[model samples]
Target: MEADLPHLVAFMLGTGVRIGEALAVHWHEVDLEAGTVEITHTIARVRGEGLIRKVTKSRAGERLLHLPNWALAVLRARHAAGILNDPVFADTRGGYRDPSNTRRALRTALSPVGNTARRDLGLSLRTLRRETGMTRKQVANHLNWPQNRVELVETGRIKVDHELVRTLVATYNVDLEQFHGLLAQIHDAVQPAESDKLAWIRSHALRKTTATALDQAGHTARQIADQLGQAKVSITQDIYMGRQSANPAAAQALEHAFDDPDLL
Candidate 1:
């Protein structure tokens, strides 16, 4: 009963439900009959305070997200358990879900996919965000939420959109349109990389040291990750190591990294 975190997290990410929104979801918020989820609130806990239910982060936070077929199936499986009206994600006490526990669960679930460590997890999350590239404010705006609250829903940060689905199809060359409205029927897939990961390996020393050189060259974490075949969290670790010296083309690389979508 407590072991489905990975699938659940992947479903939430696919749905763009933000961590807080995901935790706050209730059976009532999920309209199984309509195949939608109404995001109405978020869970938060500030320093010195225990967890509390709060209005969603922004006006954009309150939204009606049409669940993808995969999301719908996951929801259906949960609903079939007959716990309607209960918090969709309850805690140890079967009360409101704890955000920390939920995050831990998500990390735990992502373990087999190389996200077990904190650095690796951060890298994975940043990779997701960069791939999406929608800002926290943009996500909030779409969700009808306050800009400030956008950060809390980091996992489910962006609102689901057709663009994402289209990207999935186009980038992966999957004939998803043939499936019509049955999005859940499609198998999970990943897009192919355009560049050679080996190129970065040949250009840099250790994968761990590449980020520092790039950072000293004034590259952003995103840029370094994109160019070095590493993740932003890994780049941050290199920067933290304090042994990085500026490399040639660091500034130029940073400036132009985003110009080429193919590089990513």
Candidate 2:
């Protein structure tokens, strides 16, 4: 999780800025005194130029965002650290962080399993979904796999390859951190399956759980959108440790919903 951009993740949740826009942020744009961060440019990968930080496409994309308290704290810490890099979120080498690598790192931080994937999606009868009271047949239907396949997976009669992992992710509707630790464990078919992380949560644990949790808490669609910086409601969900934005109700919802800090 530390290797991933937890701070940047927090900033995105608070500002609703696109990943590129967030990456392009310079020290000059972040006004901690004003509690604001301007979205002036977005980072793009040109064919030969590597990363190109350019002005936003339109005036709308160039809007200024107010920072929540927690997000401000994150910035303060960064500023106090006196990072030599121009970009607020720089790579380990103090240079522009590639969008692809950053995204991958964020996915990695998310624990795609939160370390729970080792069991949640592994061969275990006591997996997360089943422990939540979901029957094998129900899960099978969700995966569009034969019921026998679910049993096979649980019985350790078969290995869950990358395709199955992707299908499970898509079917379960979880983000990176939920499956964060899974990638390392995914290919380790020999790794013994223990308790399922999916076993812990209940009531639609998979499939838009993040957004649904926010909605149930009474956050508006717009707020959810801003929190995720996404137009789609299905995946609405961020963090300083980045701070949770109080102004936007979604930020508060996220703060309450995600148990793990990195999940934000």
Indicate which candidate wins on lDDT.
Answer: 2
Write down the TM-score of every candidate. 0.41, 0.51
Each model's Cα RMSD: 23.3, 13.6
Total clashes in model 1, counting residue pairs 3 or more apart in sequence or in different chains: 16
Best by TM-score: 2
Residue 189, model 2, lDDT: 52
Question: Per-residue lDDT tens digits of candidate 1, residues 1-264?
Answer: 474453455345334455666777888778777666777777888778778778775544565655445556667876787545456766656677676666644443332231123223233333544577666566557656655433422333222234444443343234546645324312121222222122232111233443454567576664444333222346556556432222234434333322333321
Task: Locate the minimum summed-lDDT window of 10 residues in model 1.
Answer: 185-194
Query: In candidate 2, what are the lDDT values of residues 1-264, reduced to their tens digit?
Result: 355366786677556567788889999988888787877888889998998899877543665666666767778988897863788888777677787777645433333332344444454333555556677788888768865666555544444576776665554554534665666556565353343333333212321455576678886665554443443334322221222333345545545655454543
**In model 2, where is the ten-residue run with the lowest total lDDT?**
235-244
CA lDDT of every candidate: 0.49, 0.61
What stretches of model 2 exceed 4 Å from their correct place? Answer: 1-4, 112-264
